[model samples]
Target: MTRAVVLVTGPDQLALWQPLLTGTERTSAAPVVLRRHDRRSLRGWAQRVEMFHKEDRLERLHELTGGWPLLVDQAHRLHTELDDPDEVLRRLAGLRTDLTRAREFADAAGVYADPLLAAGYRELDKEFADGSFDWENTVTAVALGGELEEDDAHRVIACLDALQVFDRDGVELRLEPLLRECVTLRT
Candidate 1:
C-alpha cells in the first residue's frame, strides 16, 4: 500500500523533474536557465511587483488588438470562460446585443489600471507586430501568468477606457484557443 505525500521545497519542480542542460540527458524536457537568482534579479522582480500596486505597467494586458483581431478576441473569449462560463455562454446572445450598444469600459476604474493593462497590451502589440500573435499561448502567458493576481480581474475592466484595445461596443472581446492551451502549462 502506498500513500501520496506532498513535498514542500523552495526548488523549481519543473527543473527537478528533468536533468539539467549540463547533465547527461540533454533530450529531456527543456532546461530552465535560472541556476540561481541574484539580488539584481530578485530586487528587480521585487521592485516590479511593488510598483505593480503603485504603477503596475501591466507588462501584460491588452483589450484592443490592432490587426488580425482573431487572437485578441479569443483571449477575451477565454477570459469569459474564467468568468461564469454558464452565464457567458447562456447570456452571450443578450450580452452581445447589450455590449454592442454600451459605451463604457466593463469594470470600475482603479489607480494602476491603465498602466498595468497597457503593459500587457503593449506586449501583445509587439507580439502581433512580430507575427507572434498567431500563437495563442504566448498571449495568455503574457496576460494571465507571471505575477498575475486574481485582483487583476477587476483592474482590466477598470482600465478599459484608457486601453481602447477592446471593442468600444464590447461585443468582440475574446481569447484565442491557443492561449487557452498555454494556460495548462502554468498549473
Candidate 2:
C-alpha cells in the first residue's frame, strides 16, 4: 500500500484536514500539508469551510463553548410582544442551571453563582458571550424580557439558526435542562 498525502488550503479547512487526520491510519503521509489561513483570509476561508466543513465545526464549537446553551441563547431572542404559550424561557433556564450545576460547563469568567459552578470550556466567551448582555444572567435574562407565542418563539430560534448560533436541529437549545429556563429575563 502506498501513502496518500492530502493537502488542503483554506480557512474552515478543518473538514479537509479532518479526514486526513482522522484517517491517518489509512493514509500514510509524512506530515500532511494542511494549509489554512489567519484573520486576513478569514471570511473567504470560512465560506470554503461551510462548503466542506461538517459536524466537526459544530462539535468543535460545542466542545470549545462548554455546552450548547451559549449557542442556543446566542441564536434566539425574546419576543416581548406576544405571550409565551410554551414557557420556553423557563425550560431554557433550567437547562442552563443544570448544565452549570452538573459541572458540565468549563471554568468561565463572571458566570458562577458560586465557585462551584463549572464553566466548562469557557474560552468560548467570544461565541456566546458576544451577545448584547453583560453575563450569563443577562444573556439568559434577555429571553425573559418579552413574551412570545409559539410561532414567535420558534421564529426566535429560527433567527438564531440563521445566524449559525445554533445548529439546524438546535440540539444545543433542545437539551432537557436548558430548555426549562427560557422565561426569566425582564430587561
Candidate 3:
C-alpha cells in the first residue's frame, strides 16, 4: 500500500470550491491555502526565471503585483517582450489600474447584494481611507463601532484574510502593497 498527498490550487474565490467539498470531504482532503510570495520569495522566483531586474524596478514590480505569482509571471513576460525597462513598468501600471477598476466594480456589486459583506467593506474602507492606521487602533475601532457584533467582526476579518488584504509582520498587520495602492488611487 502507498500513501500520497495531493495539492490543488485555483482562483482565490472560496465560493467556487464550496459545492465540491462537503464537510466530510473537506476533513479528509484537508485543503491548504497558499499565500502569494513576499518580496524575498518573489526575488528568488525572478532569479529562477533568469529575470534580473534592478532593485528599484524589482521593488516596483512587487508593489504592482503584491507578489502574486500570476502577475509576477505576467511582469516577467512583459519584461522579456519589451526592450525598455521603463516601458515595462508603464505597461504593468496600466494593467494594474484596469484590474483595480474591475475589482472595485465587482466589490461594489457584491456589497450591494450582501449586507454583511457591505459592512465589512465599509469598515475596511473607513479604516484605510486615510492611508494610515495603527493595527491596534483599527481593530479597536471596528470592535467598538457598535454596528458589527463580535461574530460579524470575526467573519469580516476572516473574509479579508481569505482575500489576502493584509500582510502580517510579527504582531503587526498592514495592507498588502497592491491593496494599499488601490486604496490610495481610490482616495
Candidate 1 CA-lDDT value: 0.32
List candidate 1 segments past 4 Å from native.
1-114, 127-142, 161-163, 168-170, 174-187
Clashes of each: 23, 32, 0
Model 3, TM vs. native: 0.67
Q: Write the per-residue lDDT of candidate 1 for residues 54-91, one digit (tens) a residue.
A: 22221221212122123224434644455542333333
User: Each prediction's Cα RMSD?
Assistant: 20.2, 19.1, 5.0
Would you estimate the TM-scores of all the predictions?
0.22, 0.19, 0.67
Tens-digit per-residue lDDT, 70-108, candidate 2: 433332332122234134334334434454533432221
Clashes of 2: 32
lDDT per residue for candidate 3 within 82-163, as digits (tens), equals 7666777777677446756646633432332345544564566677653555555555556666376665465555555545
- Report lDDT (Cα) of residue 6, candidate 3: 71
Ordered list by TM-score, greatest first: 3, 1, 2
The CA root-mean-square deviation of candidate 1, after full C-alpha superposition on the true structure, stands at 20.2
Off by over 4 Å in 3: 1-29, 95-115, 128-146, 183-187
